[model samples]
Target: MSKLGESLRALRTRGFTPVAARSAARSFKGVLACKKGEISVKLTIYDWNFLSYPHIQVLERQDFLPELMPHVDVAGNLCYFAPGSVTLDRYNPATAILQCLDQATAILDRISLDPHYRVEDIQNEFPAHWEYGQLSLPWQVLLGEIKPNTIKASYFILEIGDKKQALISNTPGEATRLAGALGANFKPSHFQCWILRTKSLPAVPQKMPTTIKELFDWIKIWDHDLYGKVQNILSQRDYLKQSYMPFAIETPVGWLGFGFDLDRIRREAYSRDPKKYRQYLHMKGGSQGLFRMAIKEVSARFVHSRNLSYEDLQNKRVTVVGCGAIGSFVAQALVRLGAGTGERGILKIIDSDKLGPENLGRHALGFPSLFRHKTEALQEELLRQFPHGKIIGIASSAFEYKQLFDADLIIDATGEEAVSELLNGLRLARSSEVPVLHIWIRGNGEAVQALWTDSTGGACYRCLTIPDPNHHRKERFELLKNAPVLRTDGCRAFTPYAVSSPLHASALAIDMICSWLQGSPSPKFRTRSVEGADLYKLRNHDPSKLKSCPACDPT
Candidate 1:
């Protein structure tokens, strides 16, 4: 006989009668009767390599008294071993089956006496198996974060068609009207809502009564105002017709909706005394009752956001210097990418220049921001779009800021050689390590370059410029050395690059910054540009450590 067959015969001898066996399926079904209760067990070998660690399920008497146990699901499958905790001898199938049967027998004995006995014995891992329904929201509604004690009135937009649905909105009247205009199949109802924000998402029952009385009793834990308002609203609708009550609630993760029916609940209440039911609906106290009810199941739909994972970027602190054309666009892109919002992270912008008419062509801010400091204008523009974002604009030169040393990452977009050199020095002198990125445009916006320096010894900004045999220092790029500088009125010489040129540079810089934040190994430098009449193009440069460098290696 096979080892598994011998094990089954041994189990039958021990009072575990085999009722059915499927040899092809590698499964055995049996029942064991004890003084406590009868438990029908099924053992199946899911993986031959791990034959000793077979999957065990209790077909009958699957649910214990309370039904909250780790390694066990509502369907009664017993996860005999915690995930990755299986230690069994693959060759000894008989001994493994006997051990599993012994454990299952002990579990049944304890559950028959007290279902919570095992839970009380093993406090850990119960939460992992806790029964709770989840509610998801599109965007994290502020209402969900509010305290329950805070008295506030909110509204919901119900989209009830083939399926019942709802969305939290600040503008209730407008949302209802808009839903009607969209030709939704169901009649819209104006709802007065209050959020019950809990540590865990509220547990919803599988079935809830659809009646005003039930809802009244459900929310009676709140103030009399809520109970009285709901009563008045439901009284206006047909007493006999089926009506749905749409309400909004807040959880730690997101918002939730409850679309309850009134007609069914009213029918259930017909057997009770009218006077008692009225008094029951008006009963008022503290939030204890509501808290208790929230622990159970409720009818809710989860509306999760597609961009929920992007919220992780809020943990990064980024500082951008020189809020000019490239800097402004980079700062805005970081905010849109979900930086500096959730945690202690922030996006600090430093610039001493003002938004003049000349900057309107390539700057992120428009004519409305003229005369405002570049940092302040960009900060305001970003806040208008992302109200919850953390942005600080400092109207000062990058050299004057002492807090740059504490930032997680720093980007220098001043396009000034002097400022880049100063920042490189400041970074090397700091006790705390901070990565620096130097971004600038070449002559006539023909090409742009971004040089990233790591905390460890690497190429600094000055490494890009080395003295030649004639003792004249020149940039590593050939185009920057030969391209003619555009001269304005007096000594005002600038590069005549179009607005599109800086935008391309901004995109390249932002890409490098994001990659670095995501833990990519920093490269020496990256450059990009389009082919033009002057054949102005800069290749990606990989510079070696300069022996006579001042920032990185000083004698």
Candidate 2:
């Protein structure tokens, strides 16, 4: 159990009555008083061990207190305060001392950045705290001290109209919204007690602290100036960076693009540092990355075109290679999605090998068709299902097709490394004239890689994947030479068909065909890895030069 937990139980071991402690807690509410029409709050002391005083600066640093006591009541017991004797009021008095202490303690956790802190260095060297006198003492700061008791105090300021309004919001969400509305910005530290906004603010949020390295500098600098008073930061720097730094959320990059009347972040920054603002002026504020563009276009298309029907895909010619797990699903999805269902349609099923009992689990062909060649069996099934749609069966490997007879879209659905290499070569060769859609299941059966390459636009598969020059260079070349005939053995025993592997490959094929038929953006190359979700384009690849690739390079 935690040390705090153990200490709390210790209080129970002592002879303290629940009623007496509760009464004492309740009686100490003299410090709390709300205006007649304002929100009512209460306070009650559950036990003596609950009382612990904190420092003001620390409280300011940890700005979570107001949420704990959202409203102050007329009674001694706070409606939102902690389970202890305490009260907070706008006024001060002797009897209200306990009330003040109670309310202050309750808000300490909300105020202080660190509950456990020691102050050191009272001299001019560390002057930030001199305003508080005998400054830089090691103690837990409280929220009440960091921020005055008045709710009206200016925690933030913004120019809403003709006047500059000082804003001391009760909540962070409100403060942020107000800051955005008034064309004001705030540093992270300024957010400690609600927020006090002004028309003038810093260029960057205050809490960001210029750089991540500032923490180290602060520790070293403070240590030298406040030698014996503060804790040594050297030992704790790593822990703080790892555990605490991330929790300090920075301001939103820029005000929301809601077209509000508030001044833009750049305009406000320009007033402070004209040169820096000029440099920043070139930095546009919008997400324009490839993925973002894809999402936006897709969404817009979906919204604009209300009648995109499956019937539109009727006369499309699709060539599907590799009748393995993915090949089966690809064929199934194509037909279902209206590729080869009726007249004027064609679906070519290609595989140079037969199906075995081992492939039954994933193959579309049934047990009755086992032992038969995969291409013939699938073609028979397709004919049975859609007698009018023309079905072509190529009982040979992809390389055997000296030229893909006139396919609107050629799909390579095989997941073999050898198959991928072969298709890469073919794709590079035909990229200029015929567009190829290559789909393959990754090794783990978790994801699939799909690439679309045409002679007109985007990079080909070779451009996406270039063999390493250091290792296995000769072996890769030899493999490429034997590619046409090597698939006679079919997939090796190690690469077996599974549910997920084929599903991913098939999904990618559908995406490829959709992009082709509708002129959608081409699929990216780095998306080939099963674990990679973030897509990236290969910039270093050159498909035009065959010197680097023996199989596809005509030169």
TM-score for all models, in order of appearance: 0.51, 0.37
Local accuracy of candidate 2 as per-residue lDDT tens digits, 1-555: 353343334323322112234333322112212221112222333333334321111112123323212122111222334444454331322223344444544443332333222121112111122211221222211111112232221234455555443333334544454355435664333422221211211121112122223322332343343321122221222212121111110112210000011125544544444444323322332111110000011111122222454234566777888888889888877765556533466788889888987787777778988888888888777655543346778888777876564777777788666776666665665543656677765444534566666666555555444567775534211112112212224555455436766876787677657655666534443233345433233332223432455555434
- Model 1 residue runs over 4 Å out of place are 1-256, 261-312, 469-471, 477-481, 533-542
Clashes of each: 9, 44
Reference-based TM-score, model 1: 0.51
For every candidate structure, what is the RMSD over all alpha carbons to the true structure, in angstroms? 14.2, 23.5
TM-score of 2: 0.37
Per-residue lDDT of 379-466 in model 1, one digit per residue for the tens? Answer: 8878666655679999998788878766878889888889999888877776348888888887678777888886666677888777
Q: In candidate 1, what residue range of length 10 has the lowest lDDT sum?
A: 296-305
